[model samples]
Target: YGAAEAGRDYNTTDMSRQRMYNEYLPPYKAAVEAGVGSVMSSFNDINGIPATANKWLMTDLLRKQWNFLGFVATDYTAINELSAHGLGDDKKVSELALNAGIDMDMVGEIFLRNLAQNIKEGTVKQADVDQACRRVLEAKYRLGLFQDPYHGVSEARAKQVLMQPAFVQAARDVARRSLVLLKNDNQTLPLKNTANIAVIGPLADRPLDMLGNWSGAGDAKQAVSILQGIKNVGGATIRVTYAHGANVTEDAQLIARLNEHGGQLDIDPRPADAQIAEAVAAAQKAEVVVAVVGESQGMTGEAASRADIGLPGRQLDLLKALKATGKPLVVVLC
Candidate 1:
């Protein structure tokens, strides 16, 4: 992505060719030379041109200059999205992408739909289409897909390996290692064995949410929600209480938009003040409070661009109420 924000897809990057050649192109050059099988054209523009439809990027730099032998695939409907970037409509994008040396489409079948007709109309060259086909075929050959289309397919193997004890332990270790400590004033962490803690937030007990956006074929019920996780780690050594602080948002528009993509963040039917009072009561009883709240997994990832990045809805209000409680507070932005 070139100078892109989550809110906007297209943005130009001002750069010098010297800096681009030296700083940016080396890793890609290395990957090509290392015989990587494929390259994915990103969903952002470079120098006011969308990468999927930029001939200089997909063809000139990647293939002619760098001599990359592998095929180039568009990043998820990026080819079809050229119009959104002010490039053109579907047929126009298909032609532009093909001419730019894009070999495969991810989900958007613009290439499949328009390439042959465009070639017949002399808008797209047959040679370009042939080259793209050849590159993709060569990649498949390298992967032995022709020899065995079912090479790695396994149903029983999945059950055998998924949630395996060793794998689970490894995942836990990785998660532990990945945690970044932002601030720990006065050594506030390493909670006292006898600490009374209140865990409050919409995400605190959301088991399904604990398993992020890409938990393929995995059961979210097995996921450890923040409240459960705190209890598990604290054990009988510490006392813990929980409250459903507030739903992710009260804004009807956001709720509607999220639900459009099956991003369901339930608007808690309970009155907002009542919810806050409950959370406040929990906070008042505890020596420390852990507030787990923020973007649901849906408010992130593709197509979920947020212009306002702060705590959405009345989340800040909840935080303010918690702050007034004056307990040692730990905020986890999930």
Candidate 2:
């Protein structure tokens, strides 16, 4: 599919060729081996050459050495950022990237704006442009897009398959196996069905957070929150209580940026102390307390970073409060 700089958008990836081959290259190589239709160039430099304009990477390693036939597309605005990376101006960078082996310019109209003029000026060869276009067309042809652009996408089919029972069960099965149980003391393994359980945290009942970052076309409503999943498995016999112990963060700037696209942050307006008090109250009454806490949905994905990567806002306080309750504490990080 695509790659990122150090698995984060726009982050710097500085490493030796030996290290890249040993660690970073393997995944992309494997993807190439699997016949991925296209490879998106990362937003970082490879040995001081920005990936978008790195001929050695896109041409020598990816195409000639690895035998990757798919076209290379630039990550969002990556080609344009060559100027920011001190490579060149728009026209210069665009031509450089295209010659270097970038076949598609994603969200940056550098190619659209300058490639023709560059070709006329003999700055970029028409054959190189033709070659790039051929690769992209070949990928599209292989995907059967040329034959039927819609490719069987329909509202009826979407309704039939989206969150289908079989798919949901498969997801649940995968999720169950993916969980890593780091420790279990005093054989306090699975709780008895009769035990009272308190599921407390900002994320416990948050369906939106369950979908996670980059959940394309996946509806939050289709996701089963931790609270819902517990309730579903526990049935009517087991007691289950829930409390949102804290907002994901109280940072106004972060919240504003997070809400810019729409209010995905889900920052609770209640006072931090009030939220902590409620959680502590729930913990006091329950036989076992499950405190769900961690980075909010907006905190981990593209263009998002934290100077202090600990628990955000009063989540630490809520956790400390829950710990002091002396109830069996089960901490779940989102």
Candidate 3:
């Protein structure tokens, strides 16, 4: 959050041999030694060649030197984008990648579309293709896929195994451990049951935001939101009020981008000043105010980047308004 100077962007990385081995190769080597089932080549090029078509890095270094017998998969359309990296066309790149060590293609049909042609032209050998296929089949054999691919995968099985007592306890443990409290002075917590508490911000009652990104198989509706937690934890005697003080951001382009895959954040449709006023009013009538703020799930993870990683939208303004109320305020970054 503007804590340091911005570093220069090296769009295409070009590093010396010593730096490559010292910085990057060690981790790959460790993974290989740890018996990793497969390796996915990254999008960026190293030195002068794309990872998808780097024979020195893949075959000679990974397979021969390190004895990594597992198959190497291409990251998304890395093989197809070889041309974009100024390497070659589809057929040419396919040949290069296959010869290099890419046994599996992820999301791109470059190999499926061009491998036969490459073989006919004698650019890729039958032996090389056979080697790749053997490694892939070997992996499948290890997984017992040849016998039964869908073993232990059924509704009845899921019901029997999922969310068992031990798993639930583990989940609770992880949740507790994940919490990072930066500040909590003057015994702000353990709220007095008779106190009137106002919970503010759009995030306070948003169950979807609690699920986070890549919540694989997790249902957002099942999550207990911040408002619910506060109400439940504070018990029956605590009078609580809620106000959606601000949306995650006011930028229309950002909202659209975040919702491109799905609606991770919902903007209030109501005017900003009106929301702030409601929050301020809530704070005015409360003994203590709890403001739920910070990132929506889509603001982080792969392909998501930020130049100024501060509190998004008019949340700062919302906090300022609540602060003006002169009530004891608790800031909770979700």
Candidate 4:
């Protein structure tokens, strides 16, 4: 229902129908079989047609063949992207999407602006539009939105649910179990309580980075940093040190793009060499070094992609320096 290339937003996915069914289509089919209320079309094209305007995918496969009873929605601004994908202008593509069996458009007003004109000009059938509207309305009715639009939403409820102790503990427990120990040479993990530990890298103390992408309504201030987690768990017996090794990236343009929502990147103003030197100093004092690294929260979500998806900026340099310190190293990726 979401994304086309392994859920990396706005990324392209090109594959044949056989490949789709063999791999990518199963999850969507499973969602349909599970009676998901609605399905959002992926941003990528299936075969040649955009998923939003692919009749074979949206209508033939999803509705007729798979028997998906739910309404189909387009991903954010996806209908508008049809023109960019060399399909057509807003008006033409909007009609194509509707005729293709898309019931709802997300964050693009193309349908609202052009559908009526399309109908009057005989370009779009009114019955098709009516059918799409009917499906959307039926979904709302099924969700009881017509009876109570404000169901389960209140300022009091928000306060009660957000960061509740039980919820936080449950989240922690799930995260603990999800961790995979890929390799552990010399039994390096489960560090001794007596050892001096140093936690380094920009992400080590970054609470906002811990919330990750698509963390809706979740406060960054309430999130705990890895450094804090280590300190909290290590207790009085264990010795711990911390230093931020480098900013996530030093590319001014990327930082500007990431901070468009206002300082989301959290770029440090310190010189990269100075940051790495501080981290090296910290590494020297500890028996073991835990280097926390990787993308900022903004680096992987919607509209964000990379030509080279390696460690950003001087992070790899910092890692190299930590390795040179001759201390046992643990790299924790965000």
TM-score each candidate: 0.90, 0.90, 0.89, 0.90
Q: In candidate 2, which residue pairs clash?
A: none
Tens-place lDDT per residue, model 2, 115-170, is 99999999899999999999989988988999999998999999898778999999
lDDT score, candidate 1, position 185: 77
Worst 10 residues of 3 by lDDT: 1-10
- Among all windows of ten consecutive residues in candidate 4, which has the lowest summed lDDT? 1-10
- The 10 consecutive residues of candidate 1 with the worst lDDT sum are 2-11
Model 4 agreement with the true structure over 227-299: per-residue lDDT tens digits: 9999998888788999988998999998897788534766779899999999999999998999999988888
How many clashes would you count in candidate 1?
A: 0
Clashes of each: 0, 0, 0, 0
The regions of model 3 sitting more than 4 angstroms off are 1-14, 190-194
Best to worst by lDDT, what's the order? 4, 2, 3, 1
Better of 2 and 4 by lDDT: 4
Residue 259, candidate 2: how far off, in angstroms? Answer: 2.0
lDDT of each: 0.83, 0.85, 0.84, 0.87
